[model samples]
Target: METEKKFEPRIVAMLCNWCSYAGADLAGVSRLQYPPNIRVIRVMCSGTVSPHHIVHAFQRGADGVLIAGCHIGDCHYIRGNYMTIKRAKFMEGLLNFAGYSPERLRLEWISAAEGVKFAEVVREFTEKIRTLGPAPSFEASPRLATAVL
Candidate 1:
């Protein structure tokens, strides 16, 4: 007899150095709990995360992608996150157009002081990704999401 292992999503998180990365660090020092499934990439600003990076992560076995940065009006680089937001929308639409679920992508505004929130966001997103199952690139058929409909 064998027990089946549960699905654990592999998440790639891109965190802005000034705010979201600090928040994640705070979560660690504060002892807040989050899933270990995320592989984090530190960026100077979220605006630098182009759509190519998001698609590349998916192609490279990431089941979900998270981009976190400073909240509106709080960006250290002065409106960098505003560019992030615009790119996020475009990326989401691109995901949908490419026959993948847009829900696999997430954007959050996590200030350096919001460690608890960072942990919570990771936990929640992991659960969502788990529910969504593996990334399409991992599927044997590479079935288009639209095919299910």
Candidate 2:
């Protein structure tokens, strides 16, 4: 008899260096266990994560993308997370309109002191992505059909 392998989600996490990244680090230091599927990319600020980067992640086969920043009013760059939230929301709308499942993208505010929350968020996001399964290839997506290429 042949054994069937289970599917594991590929998650890309973009974390702000001053807060969300610190939280992730703390999660490790605290020995908190989370799914090993997530690949973390440390950014100077969440605001630096552009829509291009988000789309590129999906294009590169990320089943889900998570952008985590500092809590509102606590950004190391003053107004960085504000821009991040706005862009993420906009991308959600765009993705929905582009025949893509907006649920694939998630944005969260994580503070340096919230290591437990970080682990919880990763676990939840991983489960969600697993349920969604693999995403359609980006080139075949309707959103890119009209592009000049």
Candidate 3:
């Protein structure tokens, strides 16, 4: 009997440079253990992560997308995280309307000093993505469908 291969989800993480990115760097320097599934893209602010970027990641085979920024009232650019929060909600609703599972997208606020929290967030989100499996867009791509057939 053959054992089934486990599915490993690919996660795209967009981290704000001021806080989330620094937190992730700290996590790395601290040697904190977290899932190795994330591919991080550091942005100046989470507010800069547009809906197009999120859709593009899904189209390009990312199983999930995570947007992380500084905590409320602590943004390097005043009110940047507020914009992030609003955008994330709009994106989630839009994705759901477009036949995608909104759960595949996540948003978090991590301060520069929260290395452990960064690791824990990555671990938890990775597990959630694993449970959700691949993004529907990936599975439904015409190229992938033809190849599978």
Candidate 4:
């Protein structure tokens, strides 16, 4: 009998440099164990991650996308995380309207000191994505294209 290969979900993580990225770095330095399913993109601020970027990641076959930044009232750039919160909501709605599962997108706040939290978040999200299996749109329409610009 042939053995079936396990499916591993691909995740795109957009992390804010001032906080979430630092937290991820801390997680690494702490030698925390987590699934190696995510490809992280470090941005100056989570607020700077545009909807276009998120959608583009999905278009490129990402099974899940994580947007992490500083906690509320703790943005390095005052009011930046506020914008992140607002945009995340809008993006969730837009993605849902586009026939994608909103659950595939997650928004979280991870402070620079929260290394364990970072690892936990990644582990939880990875498991969630694994349970959801591959993204429906990516599987149904492998050649779907959109102009992100």
Candidate 5:
């Protein structure tokens, strides 16, 4: 018997309410073509998304995480995206040091009017993650297992 493999990557998307979330909703309403792998969580601002959320997603078996926010100087909160960018950069290094692919965590700027761009971004990011294969974050380390036991 041939075993069928699931090709869809599990994507966790943290979208800023003022921009990226609206963009994603527009993508759906406009019937834009894209992968269905992305599961979006709307936040008041991207700055609300912490490294802990990304780490938790990884531990729960998400293959990729995308954080979408407003463009620089366009933040609804006057500087929330700046914090988002800095925090995401720091998290990238931390995740990489912890043996995870930093590429799996992406930060992007998507405006509410850019539905097509949102769809395209999702498609592109999903494909890149597929090529990178599944993340090993779900696999318990020896020390972690010992602690559990």
Candidate 6:
């Protein structure tokens, strides 16, 4: 028999406090099901998520990163989500420039009331990262771990 492939992708998701974080919490309270591959880090606002955080996740062997925030104009800290949107695009471009597939990073907006949508987004993003395979950035930069630590 041929060797079977194990494709359990490790994802690090950064969620905003006001909306996306509440949405994820609702998903948990409602017993909505989704992939177990995701590990969430809650932030006061998605805008506070810096590119260094994404880079650190990759260095730590995360296969993908997902940034979730409030919907446009729905930021708890007025214009925070707008900053998040802009930072996400910049990070996407930076990933491409660093020889990594931008697909491994996802940006989404989910309101507190959309528990189902939160579950769906996690499931879909997990699937997409699984298909993309493990991130090459880690392999390409063996020294990243040493530097990060």
Q: Of the pair 2 and 4, which is ahead by TM-score?
A: 2
Q: Model 4 segments beyond 4 Å from truth?
A: 138-149
Provide the TM-score for each candidate, comma-separated.
0.90, 0.92, 0.89, 0.90, 0.91, 0.89
What ordering of candidates by TM-score runs from best to worst? Answer: 2, 5, 1, 4, 3, 6
Error of 5 at 109 (Å): 0.3
Candidate 1 structure quality by residue, lDDT tens digits, 1-149: 99999888999999999999999999999999999999999999999998889988998889999999999999998999999999999888988997899999999999999999999999999999989998877354636566865
lDDT by residue for model 2 over 54-140, one digit each (tens)? 999998889999999999999998998899999999999999998899999999999999999999999999999888888877766
- lDDT per residue as tens, model 3, 20-76: 999999999999999999999999999999888998999999999999999999999
Angstrom error of the Cα, residue 22, model 6: value is: 0.6
Q: Which candidate, 1 or 5, would have the higher lDDT against the true structure? A: 1
Per residue, candidate 5 scores C-alpha lDDT tens digits across 21-125 of: 999989989999998899989999999998889889999999999999999999999998999989999999988897788999999999999999999999999
Clashes of each: 0, 0, 0, 0, 0, 0
Error of 3 at 85 (Å): 0.8
Residues 38-138 of candidate 4: C-alpha lDDT, one tens digit per residue: 99999999999998899889988999999999999899999898988998899889888978899999999999999999999999999999999988755
Tens digit of per-residue lDDT, candidate 6, span 1-149: 89988889999999999999999999999999999999999999999999899989998889999999989988999898888888889989988998889898899999999999999999999989878887875565658868877
Tell me the whole-model lDDT of each prediction, alpha carbons only: 0.94, 0.94, 0.93, 0.93, 0.93, 0.91
Q: How well does candidate 1 score on lDDT at residue 141? A: 60
Compute the lDDT for candidate 4.
0.93
Question: By summed lDDT, which 10 consecutive residues of candidate 5 come out lowest?
Answer: 134-143
Candidate 1 lDDT (Cα, 0 to 1): 0.94
Worst 10 residues of 1 by lDDT: 137-146
